[model samples]
Target: MILHVANPIYDSVFKYIMSDERISKTILSALLKKEVVKVEMRPHEYVNTTRDTLSMFRIDFAATVREKDAEGEGFKDRVILIELQKTWLDTETLRFRQYLGAQYSNKINIRKDSPKGFAYPMVAVYLLGHRVGDIEEPVVYVNHDVFDYNGEVVEEGKEDPFVESLTHNSIIVQIPRLKGRVNNRLEKVLSVFDQSRKDAEDKQVLNIDENKYEDDADMMYMLHRLTAAAADSEMRQDMNVEDEYYKAIEDRDTAIMNRDKELKHKDEQLQQKSEQLQQKSEQLQQKSEQLQQKSEQLQQKSEQLQQKSEQLQQKSEQLQQKSEQLQQKSEQLQQKSEQLQQKSEQLNNIVKSLYSKGMNILQIAEITGINKDEVAAILN
Candidate 1:
């Protein structure tokens, strides 16, 4: 009989080992940090039409688990998803988010007593073959912790029914970091898929004996199956084929991640350029407004200067009309002076004629009624 070491990386073996009810319960309970008393397997292949297509997402295993609430009041149903994702990549974040969204959209039956529907809490557990994220911890657990703007945790957020109902818990187990004796429960549980193998020359040394973990029945059963698979010639060939297939996927994912990085860098540059152009446009508009204000001020000054010119022209016209009126009055005064001079000369001539015809000066004066002195002087 040929005895072989267990190789647990194959999907067939993992599924077969987890199909057992007792092992599945123990695994779920440990990962969930709760007591899982009941388990019911759900159909793994189903499309969630309320969200994106199911073609992009797949679940290795899923089940409805019943666990007692933290209050110790009663058992609650948790829709648990167990995923086998080998590598963690930057681009797979969106795909993961979409998968969770689809699961969240699954609603329970509508009750006649209440108008609203009920949704089950979701739990996600991922088995990673390689290191994916920046964190250094071997095992990672993610719980929805709420904080306020001041960075203080809110008690109400943890206790509120609405907030708690929407919260989903997740666990990430990294496998390549495993070596030596599996000490803890989580490490022992994860060891079922510990398929670290040696070359052909040291094939005998690569065997991980089931007796080493005799206390764990689940681990023992899983190791028995893996040893059985290693002994079979056809299953060994099939395992080689699956390994090649997973390698191809990893290669494709790497290429896609590189391309996505390039695209993201280009997008950042374009967004920066767009913001610069908007700023320039605003500055140009401000300059145009300043120029318009200056032009309006110049126009107002020109209008005021034009009004002053018209006022000066009107004063000049009034002055010219007054000079013409003074010239006409001066001519009239000169004519009147000449006419008075001529009348005085005619009176003197008449007096001389009267003196030449007079008998005596006295008689001439009496007759003419002139002064006696003026009459005598005219006669002499």
Candidate 2:
């Protein structure tokens, strides 16, 4: 038959459920697979009653375990410190460290063998209300094993005081992932924290099949405890308060996320603008360099033109001087021509007189040094 019980996801309900010594021992034994000889609640166990924000619901225990001897001859008793925490958010790394540091620093986390107490091995169990990264497993066990330089395991399951006290082991139970998975006794014990079993109509209550867990006495005891919690008026009221608190926290986180997204968008836009401005500055610098080159070329062309102009001026001056010399030569030639004309005229007159007096054409040609035909033609 399906039975109604208080949802153990609530801090108040979870505290109530784990408060039982039998349940705690049963759970520890199932998870660690060790025979728990004794269970003692540590002083640090508490439920944060503040409704301001969602916080870790943590509990600590010191368990005496009965285990086989190293020689496999007999049994031995060992005391180990266990820290169990339940959290709804994934952002608990710093908080987990701080809590763990406190446990390590605690003076009572020691076993009494010598005059001074020796440190006990530490075990951390986290009941995460949310999923961890991409791991889909319901239970994750993290243990430390010593290895030699040859890449071989030193001691497979043997516990050493020096190593155990200094280092620790951890078990993380993702409660959200415990859906339809009851293959082991540990998973079955952890089914109490499964959110899927919660009643569809009500968030505070869960419907479980009693017949399935009827064979297990410890499991039946746990269901009875949760059933009592469901009837308790005060526990029910506390569950409601927790619901409101978680709602407020979710709303606040959403707002912060939205604000961060807006800031990221603005930052991206500013980055793009900065890149564009840089490109424009480079283009302007290139244009300035090109203009400088063009100015230099123009200066060179102007210098060449000036040299050509000066050469042309020199040639013009030389031409002018040659023209003056040619004009003078022409004037000298004209004067000489005039002198020759006068002499010719005088010779012609003399020739006429000599011809008229006694000389003939031969004498006239000899005197003038002209041909006889030319002298006759000149006279005619």
TM-score of each: 0.51, 0.69
Give lDDT tens digits, candidate 2, residues 276-355: 65565556555555655555666678987666555555555555555555555655655665577578768767776677
State the weakest 10-residue window (summed lDDT) of model 2: 45-54
Best by TM-score: 2
Q: What are the C-alpha RMSDs, in order, of all predicted structures?
A: 46.8, 45.4
Model 1 regions more than 4 Å off = 1-6, 46-91, 108-115, 147-161, 195-206, 229-238, 247-380
**Which runs of model 2 end up more than 4 angstroms from their true locations?**
45-53, 156-158, 268-380
Instruction: Give the count of colliding residue pairs in each prediction.
Output: 0, 0
The residue-by-residue lDDT of candidate 1 on 115-219, one tens digit each, is 444344456676666675676655789877879999999866474435545676778766666654376777676655554644366332245555667887766
- Model 1: lDDT of residue 314: 52
Candidate 2: pairs in clash: none
